[model samples]
Target: MKLAYFYRNLNQGGIQKMIVNAANYFVEQGNDVSVVLMIPGGEYVSLLDPRIKLIYFRSLKKSRLFFSFSDILKREKFDVLFTATPSLNTFTVIGRLMARVKTKIVISERNNTVVFFKNSALTLSKLTFLSIPLLYRFADAIVAVSKGLGQSLQKVALIPANKIHVIYNPAWSPELEKQAGLPVQHEWLNDDTVPVLITVGRLVDAKNHALLIDAIALLSKKREVRLIIIGEGPLREKLQSQINSLNLQDCISLEGFKLNPVSWMSKANLFVLSSDYEGFGNVLVEALAAGLTIVSTDCDYGPAEILEDRYGFLVPIGQVNALSEQINYALDHPIDRDLLISRAREFSVNQIMQHYQSLFSTLIS
Candidate 1:
């Protein structure tokens, strides 16, 4: 099978990572796999599988229509075109019209299509909401990262429920765990006695990191806890203001975008996700794989389903009081690390690869 995966960028994002993983897995299984990055001249090209061919449509941009992609697809002769993200779907739709290849286009929606629109401006949000139903009809199959996300597509986007399939993101399990010892260079975190609460994700509005800061402010009054937020984004200034206003400068530390978060995950005592909503909490799965006790907002789709039955605690979304209480509870009552690690195996790379392979085979057959 000649499989071509398309995504908006090759940057360090959940959807991009999933595409890379699926493409590499298929390549290893003796399939001709290639990844087509819609965004031209983007960094992180080296992060892709060296065995799998990579192509960048330099003319493609997020705001513009993907006119050049059709030519690329025609030349590549892909049997199957698997595209992730909404913008790329537009190109896939266009490619289907222009290309001669018998391409079965599969579109993957990585975020909640409806909830995402609500965060935008009034005019733009209305336009996006209206376009989703029309855009979804273009794909042969639509993949949602969670069942809730699929339901949203059917209910809000008005796509048929049968058109969507829920596929959860795979967790990272590094071969040979990095040593648990703290680096001597991290002078602020030299004391190994303090409980470290880490949150890893892009510092954006949907992530609702401000709620985490507020919860930390409350948690700090009673316990000697340290908060480490890993990732950088446009919201840094606003978040910094909130931290300063709450006088949480000492309690919270912003570790901007570490190349290897798995290393930090290994050293952290707890992992936290304070998002308003999530398609599938990828970081939560990573935290579980790292054997960290977890506490997450009972967000729309992913967290409750993933952290169900004592694997972790799930508080109501955006409830600062409840979030603080849960954090305090988790700090006091230690979870069985072995149990957390065991549960995480369900989303291992091998298991997820098999699931994806079966799905692709079914789709193509």
Candidate 2:
């Protein structure tokens, strides 16, 4: 099978990581795989399997990129074209139609698009939301990362219920286990005396890291705790000010992005996710793989489904007191690490990719 995956870039993002994992896995299975990008070069570019082909366009403009994408489809005539997110998927669908190609298009929804753009003031967000129902129905298959997310997309976009499929992200791989064992140099993690809480995500508005900072400040009064926030984004300065205002500089560390956050997760005492919403929380699975205890906001779609109330603790979103209380409770009452590890295995790349392979086979046949 010749599989072509499309995305904006191979940047440090959950969706990008998942695409790279799928491409790598499919290539290893003796299928021809290619990753097509609108922008060239990203953090994950180095991580791509050498056996897989990578094609990128120089045009930053979406209109120009759409034409280039159509050219590729007309030339390559891939067996399956798999892409994700709203805007990029829209581009792929329109481009395929323009090319008049027979490529089977599969677009995966990685977030709650309705919730994602609901409060946004950007014209682009409005356009993307409008484009969802209009363009997405044209695809061969539509994948939502969680059941809750799938239902939401169907409701807002009025996509046929039969057209949408719920597929969990390939959040775990054997390579992650190897990376988890690697040594981390963080002082707080090294110190067994003080408990370390780690959260990995872009410092964006949706992540609600401000809530995490407040929760840590409250936790600090009761006990000794340190938080390391991995990943960098536009909200760094704002987050830093919040930390300073609360005098949580000592307790909270904005560690920025790391290539291998699994190593840090493996060493941390507890993992936290304070997002306002998610399509699926990939870090929760990565934390489980590291055998770390978790306390995540009971956000729509992902965390509840992943933790299932048994593997970890979930608190209502944006409640500083509730989040703090739960964090304290989770630290005091530790769940079985092996149980978490067992749950993480369900999301292993090999297992999830088999489902994808089945979908592709059915589409192309």
C-alpha lDDT of all candidate models, in order = 0.78, 0.91
What digit string (tens of lDDT, one per residue) describes model 1 on residues 1-365?
88888877777667766776677678888999988876653345665668888787757455444456767777888878888666566557766777656788888877876677777777855665677677768787888888888887788657878778887876554431342232424544566888889999988999999999999998888888998999888999999999999998887988887656756876777889999888888788777777889999988878887888789998989899999999999988868988877777777777777877777788788
What lDDT does candidate 2 reach at residue 336? 92
Q: What is the lDDT of residue 232 in candidate 1?
A: 83
lDDT of 2 at 54: 89
Instruction: Report how far off residue 207 is in candidate 1 (Å).
Output: 0.6
lDDT of 2 by residue, 84-136 (tens): 88888887888899999999999988887877788789998889889888898
Which segments of model 1 are wrong by more than 4 Å? 40-44, 61-65, 122-125, 174-185, 188-190
Per-prediction TM-score: 0.92, 0.98
Best by lDDT: 2
TM-score of 2: 0.98
Q: How close is candidate 1 to the true structure, as a TM-score?
A: 0.92
